[model samples]
Target: SAKRSVVSVSALAVGDKLPSDIKLSYFDVEGNMQETTVGSLTKGKKVVFVVVPGAFTPTCSLKHVPGFIDNADKLKAKGVDTIGCVSVNDAFVMDAWAKQLGADGKILMLADGSGTFTKAVGAELDLSDKGLGQRSRVYSMLVEDGVVKVVNNG
Candidate 1:
């Protein structure tokens, strides 16, 4: 059933360029909300962008996010410019979650509060039945210069 749900949601594919005008929010180290675009973050860089269903959720907190946090150094050694964790949550919640998980400076916590980028990439997961409303499907992508090089939807 989970696999079926994932299959039903269309996701970004390899070789696909990230959509423009996609806005994402995040909190800086100073605790200030900053708005950024997908292009700006991925332009001319090798980014490992991971999307989770929600911030602070059990799976994301205990496993998905931790995997990246634990492997941050190794991933960077391999030339990953940035490791970003995106979720359908507000910037404040994302920031708090990052702090709780000790992800500061290790992983960039990106907030897709409006689900704009998720929808643009066709990875929007409808979890209304579970009372989570619209969220992102669990997925990761290797983005190089704004073009998707690899995609893994779990």
Candidate 2:
């Protein structure tokens, strides 16, 4: 059975500060593990975050990510300082997926491997019946200076 997401889409309104305690990891250009906080990423900067169900899911691969990649320039033109594609996958998978999509400079591939960030943001979607474990719901958000400016949940 498909279950509704745990995240209260209505509650994450504009001006709400996203949980900063969640730790996210990713592979740097040197392929070494790098750790960062949501606060570090959004503090004093305009950021567009595209959260996905998984790294290589069909809809995410065919449409969601492509949409961001294609419109990255426009988003940046409109003052989006950073565009991130986050998923509950490990850093290696995120890095490889980014490369596969040719997203080198177009999008920042963020890894929330432990689902800590996803759960912290109230976006955790349980799919354990399918053996996939917890994942993030598909959504987009605009954050600035550590506060949410806009949230579009799908």
Candidate 3:
């Protein structure tokens, strides 16, 4: 049998509207499962969505998240409304990771447990061969009023 792969799609870029159907589930600081849609989160604000493969991973733990955490205030002062960290992990894991990284209040920890949101954004990375299921690619985007304005990826 031929190996199956996720369908390739054009990555989201500046001027594209975030898919309204992409709903992300997250746990509040108090550990409550809360549901939010992409439109609800970025509807009328300047949001920075920092997407990582997983929570607690080395690079994401040591670098990607830290950069956002440390520069959160600066970004806010410059007019950013929110900085959200998203991963293909469950709400419990995401909440725990947020506390572990001291990002509970500094950043919005969003759990895309289903990877639906990730795929909708054209950033899903397949890692099933490595024992990990479909996950999000590491990337960040600046969204304003639900429209992408900037994208950064390594």
Instruction: Give the alpha-carbon lDDT of every model.
Output: 0.91, 0.87, 0.88
Residue-by-residue lDDT tens digits, candidate 2, 1-154: 9997765543467888988767787777767778888889888899999999899888899999999999999999999999999999998899999888888788889999888878777778888988889888888999998899889887
How do the residues 5-109 of candidate 1 rate in per-residue lDDT, one tens digit apiece? Answer: 446344688899998579999988888889999999999999998899999999999989999999999999999999999999999999999999999999999
Please state the error at residue 26 of candidate 3 in Å: 1.7
TM-score of each: 0.93, 0.89, 0.90
* Candidate 3 per-residue C-alpha lDDT over 26-128 given as tens digits, one digit per residue, 9 for 90 to 100: 7776778898999899988999999999999998999999999999999999999989999999888988899899997789999899888888878878989
Error of 3 at 69 (Å): 0.4
- Model 2 lDDT-worst window of ten: 4-13
Indicate whether candidate 2 or candidate 3 has the larger TM-score. 3
Candidate 3 residue pairs that clash: none
Ranking by lDDT: 1, 3, 2
Candidate 1: residue 120 lDDT (0-100) = 91
Q: Rank the candidates by TM-score, best first.
A: 1, 3, 2
Candidate 3 deviant stretches above 4 angstroms? 1-10
Error of 1 at 62 (Å): 0.5
Clash count list over all predictions: 0, 0, 0
Instruction: Report the lDDT of model 3 for residue 26.
Output: 79
